[model samples]
Target: MEIIQIVGLGLLTTVLVLIIKEQKPMFAFLLTAFTGITIFLFLIGKISSVIQVLEDLALKANINMIFLKTILKIIGIAYIAEFGAQIVRDAGQESIASKIELSGKILIMVMAIPIVSVIIETVVKLLPA
Candidate 1:
């Protein structure tokens, strides 16, 4: 049902954008951006519920909350960056969209540093001295 709703909205927006693009390209871009944001907002509840389930599983498995939180932040950044890049690309700014994607990858690597360090340390500890 949710997918149907999302697809329907997307199809409708596409038609409207096509119609307005020739007359007012800027307005068409704005409409596309707004619709994308609206869909993202509509799915926030579902996202939160999935996050809650992840948190519950992490707790049950005795995983570190900090690591879980960091991973979640990384995922959030990836999705947001991709979304932003798509919008920019839709507006005909391929260069800017690529920069956005690059920024996201850099941020993800930065955020992953601590986890990587922890794993390396654990591996070192397991090796013979």
Candidate 2:
């Protein structure tokens, strides 16, 4: 049922966007954005549930909250970056899309430094000293 709904919505939007693109490019772009937001809205509940499960699992595993949270944030950035890049690419701005992806990667790497340092320090402590 979910697949059916998603496919139906996707097909409907595709037809609508294609038909409207020639007459109103701006409107087509707005329609595409609206459709994307709508789909994201539909998935928000699922996203939250997944986040909660991850948080609980991390807690149970005795993982540091800061590191876990940072990792999740990095993952979120990657996903959002990919989404934005795809949208830009769809609008025929491949160069800008690539830039956006690069920025996301840089941000993720910066955010991961603390976790990486912790890992490195732990490994060093475990070595014969």
Candidate 3:
């Protein structure tokens, strides 16, 4: 039922955007952005529940809360960046979209440095002195 609703909304938006694109491209772009936001908002509750479960599991596993929060922030940045890039592309700004994606990649990589360093240090510790 959820998939059906999402698909139906997608189809309807496609039709509306197609029809309005030529006459009022700005409006069509706005519609696309609104649709994206609406979909994300619809999923927010589910996302929150999933995040809560992950946090609980991490706590049970004795993982550091800071690391979990950092990972979550990185994921959020990725999703938001991709969403923004896609919206920009849809509005015929491929160059800007690519830049957005590149920025996202850089940010994600930067955030991952701590985890990567920890892994490297762990491996080094395991090596024979």
Candidate 4:
């Protein structure tokens, strides 16, 4: 079953990481990164399907599509940035990982500005004199 495959992959990764931990520590680092990315790749399809459902629900609820899409984009960017940062940290590049996280925060704010402006505009329009 799917659970078995998932568990198997995780166990394999853990064992390999342990085995490499004493030898080439850098290989262990790479192994961890590869494992994380592999797991993310497996989940990517499910995430896309869930997003489609969320979009459908938003449409049914008369929610603003642009706002929904913006939120989804922010989620995606955060996930990817976090993954990258973790991988960098696993590779012993803590400083680079922190920089990546900082950049991700800035990018998220930049992406959110338009949505924030739109909300403000809507509020202002509703409060007309």
Candidate 5:
């Protein structure tokens, strides 16, 4: 489907969310969550194509696959964490959402440590006697 169609679907979902929220709050939340996930799945193909192009460029530039993979993982973590946090906030749990964001940041840093260490090691070895 075209992006305009997706946008129309999103608008319809928003109106439904508001209508259902008053009578059946649980169902409203479930519908909103499902719509968000459905939209994400729909857009995955576009994201994958973009990532493929980036991978080709990185390969042409002789970038390390391990580093590139780690960066992608970090980006994935950030996106998922933000998505979850926004849902939590919508459900009226701001404090919990903040904690989720904090944990995401920590996890990203942990994943990046290996790449940092590799750079440090390379720098150390390059010193001349």
Candidate 6:
């Protein structure tokens, strides 16, 4: 049902954009950006519920909160970067979109360093000296 609503909205926006694009490109772009943001906003509640479930599972498994929080932040960065890149791409700025994606990748890598190092150290400890 939600998907149907989303699809309907998307279809409506597409038609409107096509009609308005010739006369007002700027408005068309703004409408597109607004629709994208609206969809993202609609999903925020679902995202929060999923994150809550993840937190509960992590607690039950006795996982490190720091690691969990870091992983979540990385996921957030990925989603935000992709969203931003798509918006920029819609604005016809492919180069900027690529840079945004690259920045997201670098940030994810940086955020993961501590977890990666811990895994490596654990493996080394388990091996014969």
Q: Which residue pairs does candidate 3 place in steric collision?
A: none
lDDT (CA) for every model shown?
0.99, 0.89, 0.94, 0.90, 0.92, 0.98
Residue pairs clashing in model 1 are none
State the lDDT at 107 in candidate 5: 100
Stretches of candidate 4 exceeding 4 Å from the true structure: 1-8
Better of 1 and 5 by lDDT: 1
Model 3, range 73-94, lDDT digits (tens) per residue? Answer: 8999999999999999998999
Q: Poorest 10 consecutive residues of model 4 by lDDT?
A: 1-10
For model 4, residues 1-129, the per-residue Cα lDDT tens digits are 766888899899999999989998988988888888788889888899999999999999999898899899999889989989988887778999999999999999999999999889989999958
Compare the candidates by lDDT and give the number of the best one. 1
Q: How accurate is candidate 4 locally (lDDT)?
A: 0.90
Error of 3 at 13 (Å): 0.8
Q: Count the backbone clashes (under 3 Å) in each candidate.
A: 0, 0, 0, 0, 0, 0
Per-residue error for 121 in candidate 2, Å, reads 0.9
**Candidate 5 wrongly placed segments (more than 4 Å):** 120-129
Judged by lDDT against the true structure, how good is candidate 5? 0.92
Q: Model 1, residue 83: displacement in angstroms?
A: 0.5
- The Cα error of candidate 2 at residue 7, in Å, is 2.0
Q: Write the per-residue lDDT of candidate 6 for residues 4-71, one digit (tens) a residue.
A: 98999999999999999999999999999999999999999999999999999999999999999999
For model 1, how does the per-residue alpha-carbon lDDT over 22-114 read when each residue is reduced to its tens digit?
999999999999999999999999999999999999999999999999999999999999999999999999999999999999999999999
Between candidates 4 and 6, the lDDT winner: 6
- In candidate 3 the C-alpha lDDT for residue 124 amounts to 100
For model 6, what is the alpha-carbon lDDT of residue 124?
Answer: 100
Which ranges in model 6 have alpha carbons more than 4 Å from their true place? none
